[model samples]
Target: MRHFNHLLQRLRKIVAVALLSATTAALAGIAPAHADWLKAESERFIVYSDGNEGKLREFVQELEGFDRLLRLRMGLTVEEAPPRKLPIYLVGSRRGLLQVSPDLAENIAGFYMATDEDIFGIALRDQTVNTLKHEYAHHFMMQNFAYPYPGWFVEGFAEYYATVEIEKSRILVGKYNQNRAYWLQAASWMPMTELLSKRPLQTARNRDSYYPLAWLLTHWFVGDPDRQKLLSAYLRDVGEGGDPVEAMQRATGLSPTELSRTLRRYMRGPMPYQIMTLSFPQPPVTVTRLPRSANDLLLLNQRLKVGVPDDRRPATAEEVRRAAARHPDDPLALLALGHAELHFGDAAAAEAPLQRLLAMEPDHVEALQYLVRARMEAARDAESPEEAERLENEARALLHRAYRADDANYATLLLIAENRAGGAGSPNDNDVTVLEQAFTLAPQLGSARINLAQVLMFKDRNAEAIALLEPLVNDPHRPSSGAREMLLRAKGMSEAEADAEEAEILRQGEAEDEADGEEPPTGN
Candidate 1:
C-alpha cells in the first residue's frame, strides 16, 4: 500500500507538470493587464467585474439561474433572504485573474474560495457566466449539505451544473459538457469498484481521469430512471455510514467487471442530455461602477496574509485612509479604513471610520464589532474613572448590538468571553462555556486557544490548560510568550513567581506597543 501510494504521488506530480506546461504554452502571448473594476449587487451575489455591462448582466442572469436550479434539484427550499451573500470577481482577462491568485492560475478556468467570513469566486471575464455557475454550484453544495459527499459526486455535480443555457425568459440546465465528454472519450475509464473506493487524495491525484469519468458516470446515472434510483440508494447508504464500495455493489447489484463493461458501452454510444428549463422570480439587483481606487481597496481588504510578514501594512493603511478621505461618504471605503486602522493597532483612529460606517449602515455586524474594540481601547486610555466607565458601557452596548446582528461571529464570541474573564475576577462558568464555544467554532485561532487556556489555569484545571497551551507554544507561526508563561504556571510554578515573569513579559509588550505608538492591550 505504501509503495502504491508513492507511485500515485509521483504520477500526480508528473501529470501536474505536464498540465502546467500545456497551460503555459496556451497562454504564451497573454500579458497581464489591470482594469477598473465595477460592482453589482443582487440579493445573493455581489459581483465585481471589469467586463462590459452586457457581460455583467449575463453573469447576474446565469447566477440566478444556477441558484434556482440548485435549490430546486437538491430539494432545498428557497429562502426569502439568504443569510450570506457570495462575492464574485470577474477579471477582464485570464492574465488579470492570474494576477489575483498566481499560485492557482495554472490550467484553472476559475475557482471558489471560502474564508472564515465568506465564500467568494474569481474568474476570467470571457468565462464569467460558466465559471460562476460551476463554482457557485460547489459553494451551494458545501453551504447546504452537512454530510461528507464523495469527491466524484461533488465534482460531477458541479460539472453537471456548469453547462447552463440562458434563454429569453428561462434557463436550461444539465447541458452536455463538451470538454468533459472529449476527455472521457480520450481516456480509459477506471473500474467502478476502484473509483467508488478512491479517497479524495487518490481521486485528486488522477483528476484528469477522475473528473471526466465522474461526470460521465453521474450523467449516466441521472439520465436513466433505474440508474438514478440506484445512485440515490447508494448515496443514502453512504450517508448512513455504509462502506461506499459495498453500498454501490448492493445498490446496483452489479459486479465490478459488469459495471466497467456497462460504463464503457455507455461512453461509446451517443450520450443523452437530461436538460431541464427552470424559471423563477429573481430578486432586484443593484449595479454600481466603482472607481479604480475603490477596486484596489476592495482587493486589498480581501487579500489574506496568513503566514507572510507584511512590512508595508502601515503604508497600506495610509493609502486606505487617503481613499476614505476622498470618498468620505462611501461605506465600503470607510469600512476598509476602519479595518486598516485596527490592523495597524490604532483602535482610536479606527473609531471615526467605523462610526461613520455605522451611521451609513447601522446594523453592520463587523462595524459594530470593531466599534466595540475601539471603544474598549478608548476606555483603557480614559484619564478619569467616570470617563472610563462610560466608554466601557458604550463598548458593552455595541457588543450587545453586534451579538444581536450576528451571534455566530466567532470573534464577537471570543471578545465577550475575554471581557467576562478579565472583568473583576477569574473566569466564571459562563465565561468558560463561551470560550469553549468560540474555540469550537474556530479551533485554528491561536488567540482563542490561548485565552481559553488562561481561563482554564485560573480555574485550576492545569491539565486542560497544559493541553491547550502546548500546541500554541510549539507553533512557529504564533509566538505567544504569555502562553509559554501560562504553561509554566499550569505545570505547577508558584503563583508569585509566575506573576513576576508574566509582568516582565507584559512590560516588554507595553514598551513595544508604546514605541510603535499603539494603545496598551485592553485584554483583547
Candidate 2:
C-alpha cells in the first residue's frame, strides 16, 4: 500500500541495474587459461559463481580482513593449509533463503549451523560482514581442534569474537544478535546446562533464546577473569580428549553440574548492555493506490506510519494503538503494529495483531510476509521447545505463502536461490530447475542470473553461461565497470587485457557519468 518514495525508487533502480550489469558480465567471461588461483589475495578461497566481479573482490577483501582481525583477537595463526575452504554465497535479498530450505530461510536474513557440510549463505550486505565473521568462527573452531566443547562455549565464544564495535555502535553477530535497535536487551536467563545439552536442531528451532544465550555465555567467559581462565582450560582439556565435565570440575573447582548452575545464575544476573543502531536512517514512507478495491487499506497504511517513526518514544506506542483500534480490519495497520513490535524487541506482542490480520485477509501478501517474521521474533521468547518449534514452523508457512503468491518477487526469489545454493549440491536437476526458474522470473535481476551462470560454470556449461552475459557486456547502458569486467571474464581474456579494456572504456565514459552525476549503475 505504501507509495514508492524517491529514495526507495532510486534504490530500486540502482540495485536493479547494478545487479543486471554484474550478472551480465559474469556470464560473458570465459574460463581462464591459467592455473592461477581465482580468489582475491585476502581470502583463502575464491568463488566463481555469480560472475559479479565487484562483489567477488569485496568478498575476498572482507574475508581477509576478518581473518586478520581473528588472528589478532584470538591469537590465531592462519594455517598454510587452511583446512577446506568454505564457499560463501552473498545474496541480494532476504527472502531468497526460501529457495533453499522452505522452512529455515523464511524468517532469518542469513543461515548456518546445518548438518550437511558445504552449506552456508548470507543475505543483505549490512548483515553479510557479521554473518561471515560468525560462520568463520565456527569454521575455525571445528578445524583448529577436536574439542567436544559444550554448545554454549562453542557458540558463545563465536558471538564474543564476532562482535564488531565501531565508534559509538556495537553489533552482536551470531547466535546472539542485539535487539532491533542493535542495543543490548536483557533476556530471560537460560541455564548453561540447558544450553550445552540442547542439540543443534533444538538450538536451530529455539534460535531466539539460544542465539542470545550463546552471546551472554560467551560475554561472561570472555569478560570475567575466573570464567575466562576456566574456559581456556576447558578448551585445552577437550582438545586432549579429556572428559569435559571432569575437566570443568578440575579447572574451576566446581563440578560440571555446579558450574552449570553458576552459569545460570551468572546469566540471570545483569551484564553490561549497549545500544546498536543502523548506519542508515529508517526508509521513507510512501502511499500508493491499493489494487482493486483496497483504497481503505492505503489510508490505513498511512495512519500506521504516522503512529510510529524512528524515535520510538512511549507516546508513539499509544498513538499506534489508537490508530489500530480505529481500523481493526485494516491490513496495513496490523502490518505496522507487527513491525513496531519487532523493532521494539517484543516479538510476542507483534504476533497476535499480525495473525489477526492474516486470519481476516488471507490474501494480504505483505501482512502474510510480516506475519511470518512476527512469529520468528516471538519464537525467541517461547517458553518451551515445542512452542518455539511451532512458532518457527508457523513463520515459515506464512513466508512460503507470500513467496507462492508472487513468484516474481525478485527479492524473495534471490534469497531462496542463495539459501538453496549454500547447501551442498553438484548442480543437480533440482538446483538447475530452481536456478532456471529464478533466472526466468527476472532476467534483469543480475544476482540470480549470475548465480545461474555460476552453477552452469560448475556444470562445465561455461559456453551457455557466456552466451547469457555477452549482450549485457556490449550494452552501452550497462554499468561500465561491471560490464567491462564481466565481458573480459566471459571472453577468456588475460587480466592485463581486461584491465586495459576497462581503463579505455572508463576514460571514454567518465565525462558522461560525471555530467550525469548519478551513482554508477549498481547491481546490489
Candidate 3:
C-alpha cells in the first residue's frame, strides 16, 4: 500500500514531464531527437553529454559552486550531500539540443525535469552553465522546502539565483539579470492580481513578462526591509491554506491595484546590482565514468527519456535488465533495473536488483524506498498469514528507517500516515498527528488534504473535515468525488436547517458581544 503511494509520486512526475514535453512540442513545432549519449559522473551530478567532456566538466564545476552558493544563501546545513546525483544532459550543438527538446531550443536555454531520483536537465554546451544555474535554482528550492510556494515566487526565486557569477576567489549572488531587466523594461507588466494568482501564465508573451516581473517582485521582497516581514507573513499564511489574495492583503495592507502601481514604479526606477559576495573554496574535481557501451548508453538514454509521450519503457526495462546482467556489479545499471522493474514489472522482479543495489550503497534513499514497497508486495502474496504478517512488519520497520534517514521527506510522512490509517484496526491518534504534519509540510498536496479529511470525518470532526474538503472539491487534477461526498455528509442539512444554524451562530456571537458591552449592530 505504501509502495502504491510511492509509485503515485513517481507517476505524477512522469506525467508532469510528459505534459511539459507536449507543451514544448506544441510551441517548438518540432519532434524529439534520438541520439547516442555518453555519461560522466561528478559528486553532485551525472553529466550525460554527446561526447563533450571538457565543457561538461566545466559545467559540473560551475554547478558545484552554484550549489554551495545556494546553500549558503538559503541557510541549509546538511551534514551529508544529497543521496542522489542530478543528471545533466549536455547537447553538443544547438541542433543536438533541438533534437532533444525543441521547446528549450526555441524559448529557453535549458529546462529541468523533476523526476523521482534525479533532478534532470538538458542543454546546449554553449549555455550549459547559465541554463543549469537557472534550472538548478528550481531544483534546490524544491529539494529543500516541503511546502509548495506560488508559481510566481518559484520562478522569481529561480531567476533571482540564476544570475550567480563565480570568479577566482569569490561567488556573486543576486547579480542583476540583464536579459530579464530588458524584458521588464520592454514589456507591459501583468496586473498584480493576475501575476500573483496560483494559476500559471499560459501564453508565451505573458511568460516573457512573468519571469522578469517575478524577479522584480522577489528582489523587492528580499531587498526592501519594509516588505521583508510582509513576504514572510504572506508565505506563512499561504502555507497554512489561507487564500493568496487575502494573505497578500493581510500582510501588506495594500490592495492589488496599489501593489501593481508600486511595482510599476519600482521597475521604472534605476535597478541596482544588489550583489552579495562571498569567498568560495575551490573543491577538487572528481569524475567517475559510467559504463560506456552501446547497450549501456541506450538503456540510460531510455531511462532519461521515460517521461516523454512516446517513451517505450517496456523496451527500456528489457535494456536495463540486459545492461545489469552484463555489468552485474554496476550500481547504476542495478538501480535503473530496479526502478524499471518496479514501475513496469511486478515487485517480485524489482526486489532482487534493489536489494543488490542497497547492499552496495545502504544509504540510497530511493533504493530503500523501492525495496520497502517490493517487500510489502511480496508479503501481500505470501502463502500464509504468518508470512504475510512478518513481511508487513519488515515493511513497516523499513518505513521507520526511511523516515529516520530523512524526516523532512513529506512523502515518507504521508506514507506513514496513510499506512496507519489504512490498518485493519481503528486509526491511531499518532496517525492524525502525522497527517497534520504532512499537511503543514505540503499544503498543495490534495491527496494529503483528502486523506486527512477522511481521518477527521472518522473522528467525527465534521467541521474540520468540511474545511479541508471544500478547497479540494473543485480540484480538477485529483479525484474529488470522495471529498464532495464527504462534504455533503459532513454538512448534511436542509436549506431551512442551514439558515437556522447560521442564525443561531450569529445570535450567539451577538449575545456575547452585547454581554461585553460592545455594539453589535451591522449592515447587511
Using all chains and alpha carbons, the TM-scores for the candidates as numbered come to 0.63, 0.37, 0.59
Pairs that collide in candidate 3 are: 33-99
User: How do the residues 1-524 of candidate 3 rate in per-residue lDDT, one tens digit apiece?
Assistant: 99999999999999999999999889765532333555666566777776655766766777777787788767776233554567777766666554444334366666665333333677767665766787777667645664536667877888787777887666666677788889777765554554565434232123456778888888878766678788989988876767666688899887766665667677777655545555555455555444434335433533434343335557656756776677665666677778778776554688788888878887676677777767677776899999988887887887888888887665677667645655766477878888887666544446667778888988989878776665455331232556666766887845466445435434543443344442333322
TM-score of 1: 0.63
Q: What is the Cα-based TM-score of model 2? A: 0.37
* Clash count per candidate: 0, 25, 1
lDDT tens string, model 1, 127-180? 556667766776676456534455567667777778867666666656778888
Stretches of candidate 2 off by over 4 Å are 1-42, 47-56, 72-75, 79-83, 113-120, 165-177, 180-187, 197-208, 224-227, 237-249, 253-524
Candidate 3 residues lying further than 4 Å off, grouped into runs, are 1-61, 71-109, 114-126, 142-149, 169-172, 175-188, 198-208, 223-255, 293-311, 318-331, 345-372, 378-421, 425-524
> If ranked by TM-score, best first, what sequence of candidates would result?
1, 3, 2
Determine which window of 10 residues in candidate 2 has minimal summed lDDT. Answer: 280-289
Top candidate on lDDT is: 1
* Candidate 1 lDDT score relative to the true structure: 0.67
What is the lDDT for 101 in model 3?
47
Every model: Cα RMSD to truth: 22.8, 27.6, 17.3
